[model samples]
Target: MTTPHNPLCPTHHGGRCPAPAPATLLFLHGMGATARSWDPVVRRLPATAHTLAYDQRGHGHSAFGRRPPTGLAQLGDDLARVLTHPSDCFPGPMVLVGHSAGGIAIMHCAATHPHLFGTRVTGAALISTTAGRLDPTCGLRAPAGPALARLFLHLTRSRTPVSSLLLHLMTTTRWPLYGRTAPRPTRRACSAMIRSTPPATLDALLRRLSTHDGPALTALTRVPVLIAVGADDRLTPRPHSRALAQLLPHAHLVEVAGAGHVLPLEAPDLLAHHLRRLLPPE
Candidate 1:
């Protein structure tokens, strides 16, 4: 159902005020990913579930303004703006689900705008993400880490066909991103998403993420939170989720076995179940 088109709702809806509705599920994707990353999880949710997944700045259809610095702070501000404006897709209370870099953005938003929690943001699910420090760790440390990082940055800065081809080749190899259980089709879809990311966006987000520090999120304590990580995730592994759980003492932490970094795609059923639990009774 859509809200009527009004100053509150615009021609997109046709009402002066946004219609009250069940809690909305706002899904945020990680770096180098788009709103489509949540497609699998959203498909598993109940038909009546009010859901909205949009490309964060610099990803998917969202334009990346070159003038502004792209980082967690900017992303957080963007999220705040979206929440502040109640539209047909974002009406009333919301349960936010963020993955990877997207989770960091959520934490930043919550930290800066604590007032939004418990009221506008009823709950949150952080999947395969960390508060900050996205560089190589024990779980993901490798001799090629630095080299890969450098290569990625270089590739993302260039818009040449060769650079794009290289990125496509690198992303098409699915072993590093998915667990043993993830189907081939899922990996292909993920690869496509990564390949489609604008080179400029990739470069900007990567540079910021490399130095990102975990955001202080005391505000999250005011609401139900689910901190989930994949046991096999090399990037932002269990330790990261544990730290998040510690930050929010009341959060429920779940480590899914045989899964990798892309929980929304690799384990949609599990994510869908937890998201539903966090939603307010309709």
Candidate 2:
């Protein structure tokens, strides 16, 4: 008989991170992804940088959450809880790194929990994300992408099979979810995580994201920010990142050429280089 696997112990590759390091890095992933998604990116970081990349609620090891999945506020709460906890692992300043929906969660947390961000969050990186307007645009040539997304959310209110179909569409590298050079392993990893995720989790989050706005961004204007996006991304295009940069007075924008939505995996080295800039010399 096959043994059951533990969802909490995510399948992130690379050696374990050392504790009590001077700097702490918290990595958050987007929808349909897990902590393992940061494997390639984290491996490229400095050896001394302590990092924790956890599966956000409902994606990998995390649960679908008890609250209604209206928007990223719930996930933002999760981040706040972890960072504010009285744990040595989270002590000192933190560099927040988020991609896509993960970015949205970080933004929500920053916007809503100013005390947490002002005290602990020293730097942030928002990749391929927007404060709002996702529903109006950001689809793959689908003018009604937002409406279609809403329809899917309604169809898969609770744990359902609709997410599986959506997963399959995004699994293939040939699909627009990734860049042309994105490794097959990256695609495979995303497929596995999405297959295991509940439809309710994705549906609720996406539904809430439809109404996402950036009033919270007002809190992050003073924090150093990096806005990166794939030049060819059909999902959350460069325009969204550019708009976010404008909101952040200390934000810098970087556009990766020929890359698509999967910026972390497709351009790990480039992403790492940018992340390194956020840290002081070892």
Candidate 3:
């Protein structure tokens, strides 16, 4: 079934903004994250640039029907639908900002619809994302040790029962394991966000992440792209972001020193500073 035209707004909770048409920015959240995740960063954007942050299907307030497809192709279709909807509330040459999986979605969309880059999407920002897998041999490996790597793999491959247990462990006790490395406030915020996400959805998304190799880096080469990563991010790692920047001849790589996986939260001001420079004038 097609996603409903009246899909739940991503900011339905405490951040919803009901401004009129001409939204200058379309913000996409990563897997297991809702639009709320952008709250800290969006507030830092220029007030002139209206923002539309929303949850993807099967996550947040959006419909969770039949565990929506994980392919970036499907995500591209959804994005196109959102932008080309009959209502068409967004203005011309919008800036698409995505984090993690959301960044992957943007890259897929741009690659599939190359014309949208300069013609429609003025620019794109990919925060804490990778062009390919996290394999050590691939030269983009995270700092995750063998034990953590084994746990991650097991959690990804486990069935319902083991997966459920793993999810609880990660969400409850292990979440802080990652967050502790982030700024204290950012860590707390990210912890809450992670806890809010459903284990099943998280597991499903993680599985997709393992095999998700799309045209992100290749697509960014043709567009004005910004690739940012945290210096301390163990998930995507700084090296992956560097590799992605190298692949994109014109991409700007911003490394947030001392920041972790949740750079948006850890250094929202810094991120906003870069965003202001990259986004077109209103």
Candidate with the greatest TM-score versus the true structure: 2
Per-residue lDDT of 1-282 in model 2, one digit per residue for the tens?
011112222123243324544456688888877777787898887766667777787766665556535568878878887777676334677789998888988988987798866568878889877788764334644556767665665655545545555665776545657777666777777677766777777767765665667656876876778899998787788878888877786788999987888787888899999998876555
Go through the candidates in order and give each one's C-alpha lDDT.
0.75, 0.72, 0.66
Ranking by TM-score: 2, 1, 3
Point out where model 2 deviates above 4 Å: 1-19, 65-70, 135-165
For candidate 1, lDDT tens digit of each residue in 84-194? 875654568888889988898899999899899989999998889988765543243466666666665555455433335446544766545677688888887888878
Better of 1 and 3 by TM-score: 1
Candidate 2 to truth, TM: 0.84
TM-score of each candidate?
0.83, 0.84, 0.81
Error (Å) of candidate 2 at residue 36 is: 0.6
Candidate 3 local lDDT, 222-266, one digit each (tens): 557889987767667888888887778688899887776666677
**Colliding residue pairs in candidate 3:** none
Candidate 1 residues lying further than 4 Å off, grouped into runs, are 1-19, 66-69, 137-170
Q: Model 1 lDDT vs. the true structure?
A: 0.75
Model 1 lDDT-worst window of ten: 1-10
lDDT of 2 at 203: 68
> What lDDT is obtained when candidate 3 is compared to the true structure?
0.66
Candidate 2 local lDDT, residue 144: 68
Question: Which pairs clash (backbone N, Cα, C closer than 3 Å) in model 2?
Answer: 70-208
Q: Find the candidate with the highest lDDT and give its number.
A: 1
